[model samples]
Target: MPGRNDEDNKPVAVTTSLFMHPASSPHAKTVFWGMLATRPDRRGEKIALLLGAQAIVHMWEKEGARGFMTGVRQDNASSAALCNRLGISDTDWTYSVCIDPEMLGRKNLTK
Candidate 1:
């Protein structure tokens, strides 16, 4: 354990209680990459989504991620739009049911 690789020792990053796993190898691929952001309050909807996109870009750059993967609920129009704006083309028709409480709040909806 004393001579383990840093990848095995690195800690995951979390923002607003949403966690992003540590990036160990650039060649290692990760799925389900997403940013958990709450809906805009004083700020406008567009600005909030812009911030989320910025965060995604930053994470991708910092982590050396090859590509991003996330899912928008069929009912979430804004999220779908945001993903499109971020260059995430929809290629699949699968649905995911998340259990995060913060993700369930209406305030968590994107623009």
Candidate 2:
């Protein structure tokens, strides 16, 4: 739904916990979920990248967060382009590992 917003048509705040690692740093930081939604009415890769960049800027302002970390499957060109626009260079290193397989299981245990 292009150009559609919730009743108010205003931007929604999106965030998620993401693991981080630097080449020289020994530890990682955990921030909230990164936003991944459309802007007002734009389309295609440009819009996606704009939204992605805006989300990071928003979080940094609101929560004092440092950076962002997001991933897309190998073939998700749109998302890949968006990430690229975020100025994320170098595909290196690893981050936190899921501790509980059940957390990612099919069943919605919390429900």
Candidate 3:
């Protein structure tokens, strides 16, 4: 669903992409929902809420996802609020990310 073009002739649109994937951990029943975002121009419209809920249900029913989880940055109030509205509660889970320095053209340092 492409929207109006910007001043630079680039197409701008409101897109919600569901990134639910199987958890790589030993817990096979968990699904990791990643990167749920909505443009500020379309906030307060319950778009994120609807999309997330629908995706969760589909994953649970059709994909055998027993648990759904996502991480929100501590400073992102809007995302936190949206998650709460979608009946998602905070848990004891901690989200961690690691990137290899070589991926960015740097060698790993060993002390």
Candidate 4:
């Protein structure tokens, strides 16, 4: 992850992680990006766009990747906006389940 620091030398924004993985298609070589996050305060500052462009360049130029893929939760309007700004195509829907560590051994869980 790369970031820009404030004048006080404290990091204000960062691209937390950019993971590259092989796509499922066997006909062509492709890459998929994983997580990308920034500090809550810096959400609207275009840091994610810059980092995403850098990641794309790295993948295409350095790693010889053919294409990119990533997913954003439907409820995350911010991420969806960013994807639109980046010209990423809206592809498919995905579902996820989260488990709480404290509820691991419990028979019944309460919200």
How do the residues 1-111 of candidate 1 rate in per-residue lDDT, one tens digit apiece? Answer: 011112555422221212233557552554454454442333343544555565566556664556666766778876677678778778764645668777666544433
Tens digits of per-residue lDDT, candidate 2, 32-77, equal: 3333555434444354454556556666676555655665556666
lDDT of 4 by residue, 1-111 (tens): 366777888776544333333355462455555356666666667777888777777767876766566667667777777767766668663435487868776542110
lDDT of 4: 0.61
Record all residue pairs in model 4 with backbone atoms less than 3 Å apart, i.e. clashing. none
Output the worst ten-in-a-row residue range by lDDT, candidate 2: 26-35
Scored by CA lDDT, what does every candidate get?
0.51, 0.49, 0.60, 0.61
Across 1-111, the per-residue lDDT of candidate 3 in tens digits comes to 223344776543332323344357566677766355455555566666666776777777877777767777777777777778766779998868676777755632110
User: What would you estimate as the lDDT of candidate 2?
Assistant: 0.49
Ranking by lDDT: 4, 3, 1, 2
Q: Report the poorest 10 consecutive residues by lDDT, candidate 3.
A: 12-21
Candidate 2: residue pairs that collide: 15-33, 16-32, 16-33, 16-34, 17-32, 17-33
Error of 2 at 29 (Å): 4.7
RMSD of 2: 7.4
Using TM-score as the yardstick, the better of models 2 and 3 is 3
| Regions more than 4 Å wrong, model 4 | 1-9, 16-28, 93-111
Model 3 pairs in collision = none
